[model samples]
Target: MAATLQLNTTKWSLNSNQSDVLIKARHSIIAYISGSLNKFKGSIDMQNNEVEDACIEFNLDVKNQESTLKNIDSPLYINDYLDSNTFPNITFKSTSFQKISSNINFLKGNLTVNNITKTVELDAQLINITIQNGTKTAIFEISGLIKRNDFDLVANAYNHTNGISLGQDITLTANLEFVI
Candidate 1:
C-alpha cells in the first residue's frame, strides 16, 4: 500500500532585521536615485511548500525611508515624490500568488501608495529555504516596475524649476525573509 503524505500549512512572519524594501528611479538623463525603506512588516502563508495560493501582506513606512543622497543637499527629495507627510504608509495585499516555474512566482495584489490604490504585479523568486538553529527560514526577492504617475507621484514645482525630471517608471525591489 502506498502512503499519501499530507503537508501542513505554515504561517511565517517577516524578519525585518534581515529584510529590505528598496526603490530606484532615474534622476535626470544620466543618473539614478536609490533609497531604502527602514520600517516595514509583512507575512506569508505557505501551504505544501508552495507559494501558489499563499496569502501575502506588507506594510511599508514611507516616512522612514533612508535616502542614499541625503548628504548631497539635492533639491529633489523623497517627499517630492512620495509625500510621506500626506501618505504615511504604502501597503500591499495580495490577491494571488502563483508559481510559474520551480523557483519563479507571480504575485498580484492591490498596492496603495500616496493614498491611491492600484493593481500591481511583481515577479517573485524563491531564493532559498533553510533550517538553522531549529528554525525554518524562507527568503524571496520580489521586483517590479510601476508608473509614478499612476500613483500620483508626479514632479513638484520645485523639481520642475530645477529641470530635474524623474523617470516615470519606478523600480521596486523587496528582499524579504520569513521565519516560522
Candidate 2:
C-alpha cells in the first residue's frame, strides 16, 4: 500500500509567482491567441494529499488580463466582454472529484463569469507534492474548455472585417501552486 501524506493544514493559498491561469482561443480565421489572468486567489482543503472532500475555489481578476493582441486585450474590459466594471471577477468552486489515479483527478465544479454560472469539469494533475522547511507545498496542472458564448462574451461577434473573430471555444490551463 502507498503511504498517505497528511495535510499540514486544512487551508492553502495560491503562490502568485508560481501560479497562473491562461486562456487560448482563435483570434481570426487563421490564428490563435493566448492571454492570462494577471491576478487571482485560491483556497482548498485536503487531508491526505488529495482534495477528496473539500471545495476548491479560485477567484480571478478579469480586469488585469494580459495578451499580445491589443484587439483581444482591449475589449475584455468592456460590457460586451468581461465587463470588468460590473463583473470584475471570474470564479470556480469545486463540488466533487472523480479520482482516476493517485496523481490524476477530474474536478467537477461551477465556473462563474459575467454573472453566469455553469458546471464544468477540470482535468487535474498532481505535478508535485513536497515538504521543505517545515512547510508543505503542492503543485497542480489543470485544464478545461468552455464556450465564451455561454457567458455572453461576444465582443467580437461581428468583427470579421477586422481580422478578429474570437472562437467560441476557450481553453483554459493553469499551473497552480498551493502552500500550507
Candidate 3:
C-alpha cells in the first residue's frame, strides 16, 4: 500500500520564493504579454502519494503583479481591468483531482476573480517528490486557459472591435511547491 503523507500547517508552507503564478495574454492584436503575481498564499494536502483526495487553496494579490511592460502594469490595477482597489485578490480552491499517469493529475477547481466565480481545470504534473531535512516536498507544474470575458474582465471588450485590444483568452501557468 502507498504511504499516506498528509500536509498540515505545521508541516507545510507555501514557498513563495520557489513558486510563481503567471498569466499570459495577447496584446494589441499583434503581441503577447505576460505577468506574474508577486504575492500569494497557498495550502495543500496530499494523500497516499496521490491527489485523489488532496485539497489545494491559493489566494493571489492582484495589485502586486509585475509585467514586462511597466506602463501596462498600472492599468491592470485600475478599474479598467483587474480593479485591484475593489477586488484585491483572486482565489482558487480545488474540488477534486484525478490521476492520469504516475506523474500527472487533472485538477478541477473554482477560480474567483473580481467576485465572479468560475470553474477551471488544470493539467498538473508532479515534477518531483522528495524528503529532506525532515520535510517532504512536492513540486508541480500546472497550466490552464480561460476566457477573460467569462470572468467579466472586459476592459478591452469594446476595443476588440477596433482590432487593438487584448485577447479574450488568457493562459495561466504556475510552478507550485508544497512542503510538509
Worst 10 residues of 2 by lDDT: 28-37
Best by TM-score: 1
Highest lDDT scorer:
1
lDDT of 2 by residue, 57-153 (tens): 6677655446332334433323334555678777887788787777678988899988899999989877888898997898877788878878877
- lDDT by residue (1-180, candidate 3, tens digit) is 999976533334566556766665656321112224444456555555654444566677655546332333323323334544678777888888778776777889999888899999988876777999987888876778877888888746544334445667767777778787
Cα-based lDDT for every prediction: 0.70, 0.65, 0.64
Candidate 2 versus truth, CA RMSD in Å, comes to 5.8
Query: Considering TM-score, where higher is better, how would the candidates rank from best to worst?
Result: 1, 2, 3
Order the numbered candidates by lDDT, best leading: 1, 2, 3
TM-score of each: 0.75, 0.66, 0.65
